[model samples]
Target: MLSATDIEVSLAGTPVLKGVSFHAQAGHVTAIVGPNGSGKTTLLRAMTGDLPYRGTVRLGEADIAAIPGWQLAAQRAVLPQASRIAFPFTVLEIVRLGMMASAEPPPERRASEALARVGLAGFEGRFYQELSGGEQQRAQLARVLTQVWDPVGPEGPRWLFLDEPVSSLDIAHQLDVMDLLGDYAARGGGVIAVMHDLNLTAMYADAVAMLAGGRTMAQGAPSVVLTDTTLSAAYGCDLRVNAAPDAPATYLLPHMARRAG
Candidate 1:
């Protein structure tokens, strides 16, 4: 499991995260959700060791800080919100960068398979600068997948830390990527994602952490955390949550204005 206890972070004397704690278990998709500027991305950055933080972050039994850089890379891969390649690099070349930490067999084959997994089979020869925003996101995901190809590595379980992974994708591709991550978790990998879409979170996330005012407001299963009251309080606006009898998912919508008296 990936666990953080009482994580606190500040940027240039400004507090961004305040005593936030959460666990993302192996074989589950854990999502961090909140309104803009609520520190969801900052929390993710802290967990990934991209930012200095106070408290403990553990990947399984070992403190993440103590783990060697190469070993840590082997165990976890992070897909940031955006990536830019200054020089023109082929898709295959970008994906190949992921294999730097591993000496796994057949490097070319692994990269190709990873591309195929992300629905970019024919993109190997394409230039990174030429792809669309959504395609670039997928290509980056493929790179991370190549990095941690096996969900359960010899060292233990692998992890994916994604920050707004689907923010650039269309609805169909968003679902596709979420389903792919769901499959990764089902196969024993751990996934921690900062998500924006509440409905998608309800459908794809096994656990949800709601953040506001730099603190975790709630954490639990979707049914428990994605409630009308909790969401409204966190977002500072009235909201509605609907659950259909025929479906296992919940839908969130803003409360419409009432007629004037």
Candidate 2:
């Protein structure tokens, strides 16, 4: 499990996050839902120790600051939204880079397996930059999957920190990615995803933390956190929630408050 405590963040002389705290539990998905400036991404960066912030983060009860780089790399993996690469590399080569942190890691098998997991079995030799946006995102996911997936974990909790995992992905790919995340959690991994899509979050997340004004306004099960009241307050927009008759899931969409005409 991963826990963030009293986290405060500032970027370029401006405060972005204020004393944020939360936990990602094993066998569960904790989705961070918020508006554009909600500090969701900042909190994630802080949790992964990728950003400088004031707080204490613990991975499975061990102080994150105390853990060595190689050790932390093995225990947790972070998949940022996207990165700018100067040169294009083959997809296989890129995903295989994830294995650099492991000791005596399997090279081709790891890359191939991760690619296949992301539905990219034969995309090994394709140039990363040539792929479509969704495909490129999936490739990035393959790279992260190659790093984060630990099939056997009688050892320690595996944590995955993802920022907008489903952005720009088509509906099918979005569901596919969520399925993969659910599978990972079911197999004992923990996931914290910062997503802008609330409907998808309601469908896939076990718990949601709604951030507003750089703080968590609500954090609890989907049923409670995805309500119209919280949605309107956190997003500053009116929305409606409807439960499907066939499933236990709920869906959210804009209410489009009418102007006084």
Best by TM-score: 1
TM-score of each: 0.97, 0.96
Worst 10 residues of 2 by lDDT: 252-261
Tens-digit lDDT track of model 1 for 1-261:
999999999999999999999889999999999999999999999999999999999998999999999899999999999999999999999999998879554457888899998888989999999999999999999999989988999989999999999999999889989999999999999999999999999999999999999999999999999999999999998889998899889898888763231
How many steric clashes does model 2 contain? Answer: 0
Q: What CA RMSD would you report for each candidate?
A: 1.5, 1.5
Q: Relative to the unseen true structure, what is the C-alpha lDDT of residue 45 in candidate 1, on a scale of 0 to 100?
A: 96
Assess each prediction's global lDDT (C-alpha) against the native.
0.93, 0.86
Q: Model 2: residues >4 Å from true position, as ranges?
A: 151-154, 259-261
- Cα lDDT tens digits, model 2, 173-242, are 8999999998888888888899989889999999899899888888889999999899989988788998
Which ranges in model 1 have alpha carbons more than 4 Å from their true place?
258-261
